[model samples]
Target: MSTHLLSRHSHRPRASLSLLTRGAAITPAITLERGRAHEACGPARRSFALWLAASTQGPVLWITPQWQPVTLNPDGMMDFADPARFLFVAAPRREDQLWAIEEALRSGAAPLVVADLEEPPAMTPVRRLHLAAEQGGSLGVAPLALLLTPGSGGAAGIESRWHMSPAHQGRQRIWQLDRLRARTQPPACWRLQQKAPRSGLQLCPAPQADLPSEGPHLRATQQ
Candidate 1:
C-alpha cells in the first residue's frame, strides 16, 4: 500500500464519552454533549470557544470569520491550548465558512472543531453542521461543534447552548458561564477561570462572584 493511501485511511481514535463543560454552580455537569452542535454566545466568545476546545485533543480546526475584530494570538492561546495543535481557517465569506466547517466535521480529521461564525447563521447551515458532527462521532471523537454567536440568543437545532462573558475585579481574569439550553438540563450559570492544561477548566466559588458588574469587563481591562 502506498504511504499516501495509508495516510488517507488513518484515523486517530479517541473515547466517545461526555465532555466536560468546565462550568460552575449548576453547570458542573453541563456537558459538551457528544455528536452535537453546542453554541456559545457573548462578547468574550473566543474565551468560551477556547475553554471548550482546551478540554479536547487537538490539531483542532478553528474556523473564524475574516472580519472579526479578534484574531488568534499565539501567546494568548498558550494560556488555554497548545498553539501548534490548532489549524486555523479564516474565511473571507460566511458562505465559504459554512462549507469549510461542515467539511472539517464530516471528515473526522480533527478531534474538535470551533467555528466563530460571522452572523447568526440560518437553520439550514447549523443543521448540516449538526449532522456532520454526528457522522464524525462514529469515528471516535465526540466531535463538538462550538459556535461563538453574538449574543444571549442561540441557534436552532443545537443539542446544547451556552453564554459567557468576561467577569472582572480589578485585573482578575474570570468569566461567567450560563448553559442556556440543553436536552438534558435547564439553564444554569457558573463563574469560571483557566487552569493548567491537564486540569482543564475550573469552577470559581460563589464567594468570589461578587465582582463589580458596573461596566463591561473587556472595556475595563483594555484601559
Candidate 2:
C-alpha cells in the first residue's frame, strides 16, 4: 500500500483513540455513562484543542529583532492581564530568541509559539521546531500567517505561508488572506470578516462546498 493510504488508515484508529483520550480528559462521567453515544458519533465529534483555538489561542512567543520575546494573542492582546496563562520573554537578537523558543517548545507549556525575525530560519531550525511540537504534542505556527511587519524575512520551515492585507468596506474591515505557500494543498485565499466586541471571525461567503468533507481545512492547517 502507498504511504498516504497507510497514513490514512493508521490515522483512523488513532483518531478514535485520540477522541477517547480527549473525552476522558474533559469528562470522565460522559466517557463512562454515555460511552455508547460518544462511540456512535465516532472520533469526529471530539473537540481538538488546537482546532478549538486556531488563530485565537496565541500565547504567541514572537521573537523580535532585539531577540526579545514579545507575546501576542489573536485579538492583538499582549502581555499579562492574566499572568499565569501568558508570558512574554524578551531576548537580545534572532539567534537567542530562537534558542529560547526551542526551549519553550521542548517544555510544551505554551500552545502556540511564533518567531518574527528578519532572516528566514534554516531548515534545521524548522525541523527542530517540528520535532519539538510532535514530541511535546503542541502546535507550531511559523513564518506564515504571522504579521512580520517591517523587518520580517522570507519564509522558512512553514507548512503554509500567508500574506494578509487589510482593506475597508464601508465601516467594516475586510482582511485579505493570500497564500504564499502551502504543501500538499493548492494555494488559496480568503477574505475574513471580523466582527466587533467579541472579535469573532468567519470566512466571508462560506468556502467552496466541493473542497473537502472535513471542517475548514485551512483552520486545521493553521492550528
State the C-alpha lDDT per candidate. 0.69, 0.38
State each candidate's clash count. Answer: 0, 8
What lDDT does model 2 reach? 0.38
lDDT of 1 at 222: 22
lDDT of 1 by residue, 75-97 (tens): 66677667788898989888888
TM-score of each candidate?
0.77, 0.55
**Which candidate comes out best when scored by TM-score?**
1
Which pairs in model 1 have colliding backbones? none
What stretches of model 1 exceed 4 Å from their correct place?
1-28, 195-199, 207-223
Stretches of candidate 2 off by over 4 Å are 1-9, 12-60, 67-85, 138-153, 205-223
Residue-level lDDT for 156 in candidate 2: 56
